[model samples]
Target chain A: MWLSRVDWEKIIKHLSILALVEADTARIESLARDLEKIVEMFNKIVELNIPEIVEPLYTTFFGEINLEEDVEWESMGIRELDPTGERLEDGYVKSPKTL
Target chain B: MLPPQCTQFSSISIKTLRERVREDSDFLFKYVEEVYRAIERYEQRLRAYITLRPISEVIDDIENLVKHGKLGPLGGALVAVKDNISTKGIRTTCGSKMLENYVPPYDATAVSRIKNSGGVVIGKTNMDEFAMGSTTENSAFYPTLNPWDYGRVPGGSSGGSAVAVAACEATVSLGSDTGGSIRLPAAYTGIVGLKPTYGLVSRYGLVAYGSSLDQIGPMGRCVEDVAIVLNVISGHDPRDSTSLRVNVENFEKYVVDYPLKRYRVVVLEEMVSEGIDEKVMKIFNSTLDVLAKRDVTVEFRKMPLLHYSLPTYYIIAMAEASSNLARFDGLRYGTRSEAEGKLWVDAYRKTRMTGFGEEVKRRILLGTYVLSEGLYEGYYLKAAKVRRLLHQEFTKLFREYDAALSPTSPTLPPRLGEAIVDPIKLYSLDINTVPINLAGLPAISVPGGFAEGLPVGIQIFGPPLSEGFLLNIAKLIESGRSG
Candidate 1:
């Protein structure tokens, strides 16, 4: 495996606390095993004898992105994401811990 | 009266349906009624929809639609949307527990185009949760059953959209293909699905899963129908920076019954070599045999990098998914379980932990791990570089041949609960389909034939902006199979 158990545990812990999602400790052992298998499958990709300097290609073509003038337009009109509008405070959608 | 083709077994062409509606206004109402009746008959068995519009609501909308004069090509067509594509005021759950109650305030660019072209959205179809798994069994609500065999799964994450069209639940449907999501389902259900060139359609409102690879495309009973819907949805949208600026139009005209005189195409040698199920290989070979009898020039060529595409696709997709799905932290939209703590950070952690499913979480964890500081260089970077080599390889191949051919899925639809248990098994099903997405090319999967009494799909992939060309290529296979 590319990652050792200690490495896996350390990464998962850091990720759950800092990154986009959190993991339930109960599911971690199984998820770690699943990740190991997936890594075993995908790790082969890094092994291809490609040139050391091949650039990472993103899109097929560089799309011509003409940024439209920064003009005022109608927004999504969402003041409170809560459908019933009950989560508002002081004319703003309140964060759970704020106020 | 509706066209004779508008019978129970087959659907009418978009153009024919439009003309019929023009001649007899009431014709559309009756046709739509029949569609609803068909849905009522089959939806219970198929579980194709996560949210079907009530018959009364659809009727009222159709009534208003009829009062307006000029109908676009898709006039009065009943459209089923895959749940991943946002429909205004419609719950876009992405077939996950996470956003089960989340309704979008706007329609995806493709959905809006369908409405503007006079297509009526009948419902949001079920899908794999956040388009992660191959079988809709990954869906939180229920696994969608194949109309061909109730014991088997319809291919996913666009499984329900494909079944909706196959079983006469909707006139046509829009499904987002990221890997084989659209095509595999279409193949399994014996329908037609196209994954347009990556940037041809806007992804403005599509819930992102592998943003680079995800494409919103059309699914139908025929190539021309899929092409017509493609016409409506394709073109530049300033909203998506990646949306191609090129003006490509009138895709339906390309799907013609013409001879493929001197038309050259190639089959991936690896496609038929290994990993393909024996029954599916037999069907694919026969499908190619029928083409061999034609004036077209076909050859078997090896594109070595294709074998690596499945892994490359999974790595890239999981990375993008982790980043895109991060927004679903339940603060602003989607599900919010009661906060277990006062800290916003804890609430955020709880929301994501509670919201995402096992498959979703697994991918997220893997994605996050690979994208982390040291690992990104080794795993993600290597995949991206390899992706470039794969892209260049296809570009070189396309220069020699007009298109490439492969079976849409390696195997026939597995029995329910069969593939869902094994993630590698599910991921392997996308081997033939993911390469096209990695290259940002167009592909159409047509109903090739039956294998083991189940449908097999043959995909024709082409160069970027070659959607029209690919559709015509698919037409050759489709007509040959049927006629």
Candidate 2:
């Protein structure tokens, strides 16, 4: 009953697009079965009724972030950015076209 | 006086090695050589390291450090680092092919501190890819086997770090725990691992798994060794916004000198009500007997909120992982697809699909789903609310009790291929551990005893920044012997 509503194919498709990553299409059904089992395990808490005053806690610490002053710091050295040098072409990385 | 060519690094605690190294530099050199000899002997069988520093380079770095008179408390102490914690110029792979060749540009704050304190990083240990799986079997490179029983797995994503210490490959190691990654491996291999309170150790260079839950911690062959390493690593760093704005005392002193009178502790009944293997349960009961014998008070309560931890943990961790891993589009760092001319979007897709392992991709898939349009409130937000409640529950409990105890893993280390067969089966193994992470508390797994000739671990949990007390408690338990 916990897994009655899962449409893993549709979800995985939507997810792959959203994440810009794809699972192997060859046996996506098996992957779907596996995900469903994990979700079924997760559904144990899905129907949890929370008190309204409880805010969703995110970070563990409660202090203000220690921000450094707004001054221009030195840029990362070229070596640190591109250690292998194979990606850099005249100080910029060459990549596929956006279009 | 050193043992011949094959020195057992596990036998040499960090405190012992530090005192000896301070007196004689020749002893230090001989010891480092001995550590590598063990690595050469057992590394092929165990596969604990993904990238080992060439011995020549390690020796040269040590010589240079000694020459400059900059060796600190960990001077000449060899360390193994979980591959995810960036070490500048070292190939820091999070046990994924995506980062197979990725060298870090800088050290994680923890690694930087280790080096500053005279700890020498021997190599980067293997882990579950991006610290995802409960077993290191999910590693893209290979699985790290247990030192106690080679047929069994070393629980992960800190499996390699645990194995490195257990097999005498390194004196101590650093590992990151999001949902019990550090403690599970330490439990499986019969060593000590501490998952410090969230924000107790900086995560500036640790590749994010679950930003809120992830904390870098230490592992060692003994309790005092872990405490010694903890002293070197724990402190605030401005680079990590979550880093606790607090001071840390030397944890070693607590282990050595803390007067262990009767301390109050409890075990939650609901946590072990089901799913524990029979052998594991026997070992846990015996450990409690050992604790009782030490004059420590032990009680049980049905912390019903703990029943929801596994489900809540998976939802929150996967959601955070989905967001945190978005940067790995292969345009900036890590490996890229070799497919020639394609659109940028296509490039991102191809690179990600080819590079990541099955476990990593599956988490990204589920993570993306919970954070998607209408379902976000139903899944991610709900889990967060439950998490808040769990955190409050622990906070209330700690007011009366010094710590809570549990069997670190519900079952002993499964055979290499047995656990990864079912996703839920593997995820269930984290029930005792994930709640501590969700609550943002410190916990340590110390060697409990053997169950059927295999190692077991007893996990001890403490409130936020209670690492020193936890170590003292661990030392107390560590000093006690099994019947």
Best by DockQ: 2
Candidate 1 structure quality by residue, lDDT tens digits, A1-99: 457876777767887776657777887776667777788888888788888889997666467864777888765444525566777777676665421
Local lDDT at B482 for model 2:
29
For residues B8-49, could you state the per-residue lDDT of candidate 2 as single tens digits? Answer: 543587767777877887777888888888888889989999
For model 2, what is the alpha-carbon lDDT of residue A99? 35
Model 1, B1-483: lDDT tens digits are 111213553366677788888788888888878877777666788899999999888878788777775367888788999999999888999999889988887889999999888889999999999988877888889899998889999999999898888887888999999888998999888899999888899998999999889999999988888998999999899888888898777887888877434678899898777778888888888877777666778888987887788889998999888898889877777777676677777777787888888889888877887898887987899889989999989989999988888888888999998887778888998888899899999899998888667888998888888888788778877878878
Sort candidate 1 into its docking category: medium
Tell me how each candidate scores on DockQ against the true complex: 0.52, 0.61
TM-score of each predicted structure versus truth? 0.94, 0.95
Runs with alpha carbons beyond 4 Å of true place in candidate 2: A1-6, A79-99, B1-10, B257-261, B338-342
Output the number of the lDDT-best candidate.
2
Look at candidate 1 and give me any clashing residue pairs: none
Number of the top-ranking candidate, with TM-score as the measure: 2
Q: Candidate 2 chain A: minimum summed lDDT over ten consecutive residues — where?
A: A1-10
TM-score of 1: 0.94
